[model samples]
Target: MWTVGHSTHPLEDFVALVRAHGVHHIADVRKMPRSRRHPQFNVDTLPAELGSAGIGYTHFAGLGGLRREQPDSVNRAWKNPSFRAYADYMQTAMFAAELDRLIALGAREPVAVMCAEAVWWRCHRALIADALVARGEPVLHIHTPQRAEPHVLREFARVENGRVTYPGEPELF
Candidate 1:
């Protein structure tokens, strides 16, 4: 499986990148699938464009980001509030279900989870990649038409019982 960010790429360039990588299905993992800045990546247009290139598109809002951190979130290692919130959401059944769906799709065809951010580490796709790795699926971050990187689990991530968490330092009395 792979992850790609639309990242301001022109529509043709984006489609070419996916086609070059042999991605047959694209699972849109953006909370809001439409992009005002890049109308080509908007939901109403993306599917048809991808279809024209023989690629499939599906939006998985259940796996989307823009989550709120719980007041008592245990995944504190992520200093970024947005990242922390997403990490907390990963512990929920909704995330598990959506992740399962993504995995199942990947099992059938080459699939790439896509978001808007250009870099995987800067996007929630990094967290999703961690979850996929914990589930034994190798993931690749698609950087450009000629460049892709293998996903490495976040250094601070802790996985137990197949679930991942990022705990901050213990309180010092």
Candidate 2:
């Protein structure tokens, strides 16, 4: 499994970056899968572009971010509301289905999950990677052709029932 951000890289550069990792499938994990800053990454154009390069493209909107935090979210370790919300959503059946799809795809193809952020640590992909890690899937975060790194699960995360929760020990905190 791989994570990539469509940062401001030009289309060719982005293509080259994925090709460098021998990526065969690009999973767009963007809720809207459109980019105003980089119109080339918009859903319609992206598939054709990737196809021309022999890379398959699929949009897994179910795994997309921008989730709303539940009123009673248990993931208090994430100070960022967006991160907390995504961590909370990771327990849902929808997330599980999408995650299963991603894992299955990884088993069958060189799949990379993508969003718009440039850095994995700051992106919701970090939490997504955590869930994947818990499931025994090795995740790699791609920064550039020569800059991919193995994922390390966040220190505060705990896996339970194949899901991730960041409920830090109250007594310790």
Candidate 3:
């Protein structure tokens, strides 16, 4: 599976970029599938834009980010509350089910997870990549239309039996 960020790319360039990577389907993982600054990526128009290029688009709203951290979150390794909450959500059955569907779709054809952030690590895409890694799916991040980087699971992540968690020692102070 692959991940791509809209990153201010024009609609035509976005189409070409996915085409360059041979992506047949796009799984949008944006909590709110609309961009005030980049209207072309809004749900109301993104589907048709990609469809016209013979690419498919599906919004996986359940898999979107912007999750809230639990009061007793188990993912202490993530200093970012948003990321920690997303990691916590990854432990849910809902997330697992949706992820399985995505994996199956990817097994049939090239699939890329779409989000709005241009940088993978800076976005919740990094947590998703870690989950994908734990699930044994090879994940790559599209940098440019012509370049991509292989995803490396975070060194702080703990993976066991295809499940991932971010754990840190409790504060001594």
On residues 19-108, what C-alpha lDDT tens digit does candidate 2 reach at each position?
999899999999999989899999979999999989999999999899999988889888899999998999799999999999999999
Q: Score every model by TM-score.
A: 0.97, 0.96, 0.97
Residue 137 displacement in candidate 2 (angstroms)? 0.4
Question: Model 3, residue 124: what's the lDDT?
Answer: 84
What range of 10 consecutive residues in model 2 has the weakest lDDT sum? 164-173
Steric clash pairs (candidate 3): none
Using lDDT as the measure, the top candidate is 1
| Residue 128 displacement in candidate 1 (angstroms) | 0.3
Q: Across residues 1-173, which tens digit of lDDT does each residue of candidate 3 receive? A: 99999889999998899899999999999989999999999999999989989999999988899888887778898888889899999989988988888888899999999999999988888888888899999999999878999999988899998989998877568
Question: Model-by-model lDDT, in order?
Answer: 0.93, 0.92, 0.91
Which order, best to worst by lDDT? 1, 2, 3
How many residue pairs collide in each prediction?
A: 0, 0, 0
Worst 10 residues of 1 by lDDT: 164-173
Global local distance difference test of model 3: 0.91
Ranking of all predicted structures according to TM-score, beginning with the best and ending with the worst: 3, 1, 2
